[model samples]
Target: MESKSSPCRPQDLGKFEVTQRDGAARLGKFFTKHGVLNTPALLPVVNPNILTVEPRSLWDEFGFRALITNSYVIWKNEILRERATKEGIHELLDFPGVIMTDSGTFQSYVYGDVEVSVEEIVKFQATIGVDIGTMLDVFGRPDMTRKEIEDAVRITAERATKSLQVADTKIMLNGPIQGGLHQDLRAKSAKMMAESEYQQSNFSIHPIGGIVPLMESQRYHDLSEIILSSSSELPANRPMHIFGCGHPMLFPMCIALGADLFDSAAYALFAKDGRLLSEEGTYRIESMVEWPTQSSHISPYTPAQVRAMSKPERTSLLARHNLEVTQRELARCREAVRNGSIWGMAERRSHSSPHLREAFLGIIRERTDPNEPSAKRIRSIIRSTDPIRPSSEPLSEDLLHRPHIIHANSLLVQRWRPPGSWHDGSIGAPSRVVVMKGGEPPWRASYGSTVQRVLKEDPRTVVMIDSLIGLVPYSLEDLSPWCRVEGSNIHPIGTKDADYSVDLESMGLGGIPVLVLTPEGSEYEQDKSILAWIDRCSFVDKLSVLCAVSPAIGCEITDEIRVRRSNTNRPVNVYNGEMHLFSPRLNDGGISLALHGAKLIHEAMKSARDNDEGSTITTTK
Candidate 1:
């Protein structure tokens, strides 16, 4: 099942809201009764029975805001059980931040089964006042038969009623999605578990359960399959915990797929086994002449010195190192979300391992939008990306797939309409296209005069700029993006002709007779009539795309056009006669409507409504 971040809502215990996003990956807050916790975060798995790193240090020194422990473990221990119930789990663990209790489900996966039942553990976790709790789910093993996996999923869902019934409302509960290796069953489990069976409440968070063995084997491709298949089915409002997925290498892709919370014992376990974690891959201390990835915990000591230490000392050093690596990588993922560069980070991180690369590419090849339902909303990165970034990046092979670029191109196809006379020429379309190559922005210097001449002569001729981004009409050129590109590294237009052609068709541009023409090096021709025509065309196009007004009506609404240009000779504010109609913001290449323009658009829309009893249309042709 999928989980997403939302920033618009006020959060409380059992409430999750996404504050920011890049693709499906969200930088969000999960409000626990204990406190508000930020994500894409890692919850260091703490064993109540064993303290490799103290829980308080995990919060203070390691900088983790949340940690998970097994309720079953504490429940089995008579002394610890009595202490936890009396003192509360926070007092028992000596931690002040959020504490999440796990059901014996994972222990069930490890040992044959846990002695505790679902009802007892739920009541126990609630009575102990833990902030978050999990139901004992049947861990669907990769080796399980189809019927067995289905039954396991059913058993887990069936337990939700009792689980939520027994759980205290003050604590959030994890509804685990299970299907072993089968993608379909995973989706089914996700949908069934999205809504809590208990009245007046819903599951606070969802964990993708029963895939630890896949992570153990580095079966990342299958792990990605489960995430991609199940994510869309999960509720976008809750955090999706990738249960037991703790390795740093998997964090980038998993977070990118909308897995919000993760808990893993690998940091401690790997340390004891003399292995160190990195975003790339694990390293064995015995083989390391130098630390491939250094941390404060291990940088001062040589591998030989570390190996020479006492067993307990060595374990502590390595565990701290592994913990720091995990913390840094998770922070890196959050920063990527903030910068709208998570896909790029994931791209770079994918090269860390062959399996990771396969998983990244596999998702790329997935034509379906895995971040569905969420992506369909107005705040989805696809609709809300900034038109101009502060700095430009060298384009990658997956440039078209980037969220901002995808958003830009999608808006064009969905909103842009060629002018009425675009097909008014002799060829049943425009006579000449004049496909100007946009090398860098401030487009006026090279193409402005040529565009003016082309439109002056034919009036109906199509003028388009072939940019690093796909097809863009002259009206929208220098608007954004292209203005902010790094010319030195960006691929020249027409180099990726096939990809360009697909996007061009997506824009539904008509077949023009003649294309690509260079600028004529001549003195500027100041023709007033042609200049006004150009202004009208620009106004109509921007209005249609930015405000979703009909170009024909926009032309009707405006009889006068005056453009305010920036120092770069790019249009900033556009006026209709004496009144400001629209402004293409220089700070970002998005259009803002003037009050008068909004009134005009409103009038057009209200007039267009056909449901009113007295509404009628008048023909002008």
Candidate 2:
């Protein structure tokens, strides 16, 4: 027999890498012998006999890196079990990517009982050469009391000890969280699983199981609490799976709260009823006026084709569409995580289903209320409250340093209801602000130089460049408020000089002096090009000006200066006076650049206004 640990083996599978941790929610990559499974991913449930979509075909079409199947189903059938054992589960499924197997807990729930022993199932799964396997935990029914739940947990933990004794394949074990509705029981179960040496080098994932009833009942509060209590107690490194939760509507909340993998038989389940999954919501096959796709089951098929097609073919094709939809939602979620907008995506997805939205709101309500000692006791007694949402707050202030804020989606400016004094006036027109971080010169240091040049030369500019992107033209009609606020790094608009063609006049700031607030650099020339450009613009000379004075230098262009230096034609004024650059130490999360920029611009404007130069301030767009 080949050694599992032997290096240079052609058969060895690899591992997972933690990329970003946002509170309990993590973004990671799980490396398999075939390909990397991106974390916070959904693994669609596959039944071998059912063959909703062929596993290999799923990988080819959808880029689904991993999937979960039932070992018990395959094990019970002689032909299926024999073939899987002899040729390996991967070969049986014909899937090269990672495969996970369930120990028939869910089947047991549906069928009243399952006769398989814990050790027998684990050994069967390992021998099949499965990448990950589940231990047969004693699942708790919804009717189980605290004592009964405790017994189930204790028994499951005990079974884990005996099950792994015969297991040798470094095949990952799913140490499922199984404490029914009891929060303390859930926590205790998780802690026990975390400590037991039985779990020492064995388990790959720890999924929260037996919650299908809770989800179906919309008992979101209980579901949330169970996950929170269990996940917090488990080891940080291992992936956490939310068993049987494949609905696109539920992913944002679950993913936000730190779940890594999810599985659902929803595509098959929904397809059986002639329903199609979509980001907006599920659409019924009968009610569709138009197919979401150009060709759907409802169309391109003659009544003859529909009547002639076998039930299995129709079901399989519908199941394929539903699975495709599920994969699309998962892809959107992964992108949202990469862009640091998972919560926002969740907010939108909540609207997909009313029940889903209720569950989310329940979670949000529980999350907002500060926990009191009495409330904790009440929580223990009711067992009905929403899960305390894991904090969505960035892990640290420094981590909150997001790069840029482009309109990745529509909700950008509308959703950015600023905290504290950053509020807009009551019924204020929408505004955009481009916020960047750091203190170095825009040229030598960041993209500040490029931005400064754009704002300086453009007429009717309302560019307020600072730690926050805050640009307010007289109106908000032309540009998306979100688009105005440039996110952290300003990538050059591909091949298009957007800076020149942006048409500031149409944006309602045609005559306003552009606000080119930036962090003062160590040297005078840090912003010299911008200043020189502004000085030379024919249109700028006609506009009134005010700069928030920065200690660095220069007042807003003044009238006394306009008459005296009119003949000089310096086109650029080099304010050689010493100026302080915005540099908060690396450890501090403060935006020294933004603070200093705002102050300097504000002071310059103040100085200009004090000198009695008339500046028009109009509100009507």
Best by TM-score: 1
lDDT, candidate 2, residue 520?
A: 45
Error of 2 at 330 (Å): 0.9
Candidate 1 per-residue lDDT, tens place, 1-621, comes to: 112112222345566779998768899887765567899998999998779999878877888878999999999999999999899998898887788888998888889888988898888988888888898889999999999999998999999888888874756788999987777788888988996568766788899998889888889888887886677688789898998899998888888777899999999999999999998999998967888888999989999999999988999899999999999999999998887677678788888999888877766555454443322321343455543454554566766666666666666788776655431222234445567773456666677788777776776677788777666888776555655556522455555433345555666664545467656757578666665555556666767766677665676676556788879556778777878878876554566888987887788777666445222322110
Candidate 1 residue-pair clash tally = 7
Return the TM-score for each candidate structure: 0.87, 0.60
What is the Cα root-mean-square deviation between model 2 and the actual structure?
14.9
RMSD of each: 5.0, 14.9
User: How many residue pairs collide in each prediction?
Assistant: 7, 33
Q: Model 2 over residues 419-523: C-alpha lDDT tens digits?
A: 111111122322433322232212223443544544444422333322222232211111222222233334322222224223334333344333333444433
Give model 2's TM-score versus the native structure.
Answer: 0.60
Computed on alpha carbons, the lDDT of every model, listed in order, comes to 0.76, 0.57
